[model samples]
Target: MSDALTLKAMLRPKFRGALLGVAVGDALGFPFEGSSHSFMAALGPDALHAFEAHRSGYFPPGQFSDDTQLTLATVESFLQEKRFSGKSLAESFLPLWRENRIIGRSPGCSEAIERLIDRTADWRTSGCEEGRAGNGAAKRMVPLGLWNYDEPERLVEEATLAAEITHRDRRAVAGAVAVAASVAYSLTRRDLILGEWIDAVAGATAPISPALARHFRDLPRFLSMGEKEAVAAISKLGYDDPATAPTTLVTPFVVPSVMTAFFWFLRHPDDWRETVGGCLRSGGDVDTIASIGGGISGAFNGIEAIPEALRETVVDRDRLIDLADRLHTLKEAVRSRRGA
Candidate 1:
């Protein structure tokens, strides 16, 4: 096969799956963003099947939130520059904020973009650094994973630049590295070994945050527990309180959100519905959690693994697939130049 065909044959579906997975999961969990664990759990098995928007009609069904908006913004910058540009990426986020179109915008992300738009901070200095470790940066990093698949060092560097635009806390940057690295690993492997995957992500993360690395390493132990015990343990990742509530929802804090996504993805690696739906029911930042989990599972499982109904209903389904194709094309070009 020609170079183009070979790369396409190997990567197109995975790219499509990863990007589409993020959007579909975001759309599916958007309705339950602030819902508590008890509320989501009370819905039981039906929660897995439910995919829609918030009831206020603020967003129609199938629309995604800022999690996906950021991802698309990242991809658009890469496509235009043919490489990651922190300035361009920062600029891309501005229109969303200026137009008042960003749904479910987190405070950290809102402040970062606001500063950039007002010229109070440049791309390098704009990140919310006052111990802000939200998952905003990590959730939109799948494109960096796709772009830097064969360049681990470059991947880390670019992931940092991409993340620090809105999240400068080292822990938050570590979370971004973990998510993007996981996607790269997923694309490279035909089959996933849970322990090996965890080790790889942990190794990549440790250089930035040992605490987050420890959390990644601890995932396998949680895997050994039954679902209820596992959810209880994982849900407490970033918190100190011992809860009396029926369940504790996963928060937007980087540690718990990333761990929750990883836990669910590990639990149901081969089942698309289970992986993302499990994140959905974990509650709290449901959209971001499921979107992260969905990206990993989709990269591993490919586009065909996602349910047809969800694919049909997700906002910007066609645009996401097109972005994937463009990313794949760019990946092939970059790899060919590097002789990778």
Candidate 2:
């Protein structure tokens, strides 16, 4: 095959792998979200050992909550028009909400989605307040990145619009931009070094919020702090703390958690078990962290990089993979048209 065809072939599998990795990681970590590291450790002989999915609080095990559901909804909207649209996304989201796939115990997301359904609230203004910067929107944006792999700028723009459908906060938008950029960067580079990929994401996201800028700037310092110390530094900022500014809290916790997971994956690039385990051991925002880490790791290593047991157990695995394949086709079509 020609170099172009080889690259194209690789893109599809990477995109599929990345999306499935996110869902698998999310489902794995879903059962232990609020539990402490010790509590999680007590469940198995090793950190990544399989355990029964939690059924107490929200959705059932092997069933995705808002994270995977909203992601699928966004993918469905993208499929309808080959692009992201806030109105279309809101339309897509309502059906998921009606089906009870988007339910979570998070009050912020619940209220936002409810108001969006009533049409009483503008999706554009729904999360403008500083305190609305949760990881909800960012966690579901991996597909946007994959769909526009050759166009980092467009990926960021489309991701911002997709995020604004329910999370209009600048921090939320910035987080989506960062994650999308990371995926886009991963797709374009064939032999990406870990640090270079991180730098590429930082550069692509430079135009966003200053809070994100500072996090990227300090990323190396935090990386040097070791995983335990890094988690400690992040925990000091607290999660959903009403006292701290929303931007500040999210910047410290969400970004650091995601970055730390990526860093650990980079350190253990060839070891899927260790990479996902390190993400699970990171302590807070477990699902989001593992999802991001898994996406990056899967992109670099391909779908075969993910463990078969986890992949087989992923909720909606076939649908997610099909969506990813569709997104990859859209990406190539757009690239071809632009070349014409």
Candidate 3:
């Protein structure tokens, strides 16, 4: 441990930033969840501010979707149990599912949660089947990074278990590991080295899905290009839903969505708005993509990097900050015990 002062000074703000980052991005991007590039472009140059002005009719302004809801469930489970518990995580997700509280939930996650609610399958087996690889798992797995930042093996185990609550595909599990491990890696680093971050994340992901790992490895190719060119290249890097025409929107597919998030975060590691705005401009699955990218950027840049206006707009902003503080406290205690 780097001493209590460093934990309070450096890590605490990162913890707050990561959670709130996911939420603010979720809320800001929620209104444009399935929009095409044209629709987003029509919002004009001040699209970020315009997002709130033209809120989705289904949800109130600044309300986050299932992404932040399930993420909180993970954080709450860790605080209450003081460890990662698949059973507790599953139990936490059930009430949200039953209450119709999870907004804009994907069909695969919905099916898996229904199985859990009906007792047709237990937590271990309730997740969507192997081929159903969406980003549902990765969105909520950031807490695992916060909890197990220094424990790689344990992070992998817990991330896999957490992903299995709603997704079982190796690609989906890989995506979860990548997102959580990216957060963990970002928390430990003092500077951003693009290649080093990609290598570490891809190495962690390789054991589960070599293809997904390869996609991450290929990210450096977009480094020199401008955002539009890079995002366009990133979109073509993977397959999306067959139903839709080819477009710049980041799909719900795990590989492309995860890569897009990675691209935007790496492109602007310290700028939360630019990073998340990059995801927003990509259009489809904006909430998930932006949430993932936002979490990583927040971990790197800390809480102050998020704009005051955007931070204030998030629902339950104070509660999210409190949870981050508690999680940081718990992490320090766990570290102290291990160091003893």
How accurate locally is residue 27 in candidate 1, as Cα lDDT from 0 to 100?
90
Whose TM-score is higher: candidate 2's or candidate 3's? 3
User: Tens-digit lDDT track for model 1 on 28-125?
Assistant: 88888888877877877776564655787877788899999999999999989988888998999999999998988999999999999999999999
- lDDT for predicted candidate 3 compared with the true structure: 0.86
Using lDDT as the yardstick, the better of models 2 and 3 is 3
| 288: Cα error in model 1, Å | 0.4
| Candidate 3 local lDDT, 78-197, one digit each (tens) | 999999999999999888878888888888889999998899999999999988988999888889998888898899889999998989999999999999999998887878898789
* Clashing residue pairs, backbone N/CA/C < 3 A, model 1: none
After superposing candidate 3 on the true structure, give the runs of residues whose Cα lies further than 4 Å from its correct spot: 1-8, 50-58, 240-245
Q: Using lDDT as the measure, which candidate wins? A: 1
Over 4 Å off, model 1? 1-8, 240-247
The TM-scores, one per candidate, come to 0.94, 0.87, 0.94
- By descending TM-score, how would the candidates be arranged? 1, 3, 2
